[model samples]
Target: MSSVKETVDVAAPLRIAYNQWTQFEEFPLFMEGVDEVRQLDDRHNHWTTSIGGVRREFDTEIVDQLPDDRITWRSVAGDTRQRGSVRFERIDETHTRVELTMDVEPTGIAEKGADALGVIDRRVKGDLSRFKDYLESRGHESGGWRGRIRPADPGSPL
Candidate 1:
């Protein structure tokens, strides 16, 4: 498994940053190689992405989530094997630090090569940079999901 962590300070409140992260459907706007994201439900999401010329599709389940704090998920069913979490920390009233930590198991030559070459890291960095710009420019989240999801009841949203 290859691990990558990236962080960026956005000029937005903690809620604004956290809310925008919850908007999974809008990920393609800032995430590179992500073609589409569909919120299957409050705790499930379907994703289509092409990375390093390899096209892949996956379904991820939100294992744990706390509004304005963090969200963690893992690929439950798909050709992809990955898990990650995003956390938000308030630096001040107008600044929030967004952090992303991901663990990915690359399958096939293309994916492995990209990971070994740090392509994934660069991509993640670029994604975070874009996210910072996107949220700062908007100055607000497009929408938010304040409900929490606990590991004990993964599908039952709270």
Candidate 2:
């Protein structure tokens, strides 16, 4: 398995950032390889994504969630067996730091080699950078189910 974390500062407050992160449906706008994500139930989500040239689908279960701090999840039974979390840290009222950590197992020798070469890490970083841009953009969150997600907690959501 490989793990990585990338951080970026957002011009929004901790609450806004946290709120934005919980809206799974909006993930397709910034999440790497994600084609669609929908909350199936309170604790379950259905997702369709393309990764490594393969289109895959999965049902992810939210393991733990803490408002304004962190949210963690893992794939149920699918084309991928991966788990990860995105953490939020407040740098003040207007600057929130976001950190993402993912643990994944490559499927083959070539895939493993690519992962070891940091391709996955770079891809994740690019995704996060896009997320930051999406959040700070002019219009309200694009195509997000604003009322569907529940916040993490009052403190760290890691």
lDDT of each: 0.93, 0.81
User: For residue 119, what is the lDDT in candidate 2?
Assistant: 88
- State which candidate has the highest lDDT: 1
Give one digit per residue, the lDDT tens place, for model 1 in 66-92.
Answer: 999999999999999999999999999
Q: How accurate is candidate 1 locally (lDDT)?
A: 0.93
Off by over 4 Å in 2: 139-158
- Report the lDDT of model 1 for residue 155: 64
> In candidate 2, what are the lDDT values of residues 1-158, reduced to their tens digit?
88888898888888788888888888898888899998888778999988777787888888777777888888887777789998989999787999999998777766788898998999899988998898888424333222334535769542
Per-candidate TM equals 0.95, 0.84
Candidate 1 TM-score to native:
0.95
Off by over 4 Å in 1: 153-158
**Highest TM-score model number:** 1
Ten-residue stretch with the least lDDT total in model 2: 139-148
